[model samples]
Target: MARKEFQHYEAVSAAVPGDGAYSAAIAVKGLGAGGAPTFHRVLQDQTFKTALAADQAAVQELERLIDVTSEGELMFAQD
Candidate 1:
């Protein structure tokens, strides 16, 4: 979906973190064809640490679910 939206815009840019951190922003030009570009910056040291940890936990949970699903294993929905 993001790719499709980017196609609508004439210009766009992106960047990825190198050292355990990442930040990027996008700029679009035009109306519904592009609209306004969004800017986002993240410094993953202090404030970003909490968010990063939460995301890692979520990924771990997903991996466990995938393992169960592959093995035809069943567990409580709450788990």
Candidate 2:
């Protein structure tokens, strides 16, 4: 049995199209056959300053969902 190497790109975003506010998985990849991949936050540059739940359970749940390494990146989107 042989296993194949696969490269996949997945992103989740939410916003009213043409609203000038959007968030997407904009992967910054280097051009050419072999390239490096990087992630960036596009648009939606708004000041998000607000207190959140002190409960650690909720925080942990969010961390589990998104592979977050930094703090204070509280992200939430609609259904």
Q: Pick the candidate with the highest lDDT.
A: 1
lDDT of 1 at 38: 45
| Model 2 misplaced regions, further than 4 Å | 1-22, 33-36, 45-79
The residue-level lDDT of candidate 1 at 70 comes to: 24
Among all windows of ten consecutive residues in candidate 1, which has the lowest summed lDDT? 66-75
- What TM-score would every model get versus the actual structure? 0.23, 0.22
Residues 1-79, model 2: lDDT tens digits: 1111113332222222223423332232322435544434434343122212112222332333333223313233433
Deviation in angstroms for 70 in model 1? 17
Write one digit per residue (lDDT tens) for candidate 1, span 38-70. Answer: 433222232223444434433333332311222
Q: Against the true structure, candidate 2 has what lDDT?
A: 0.29
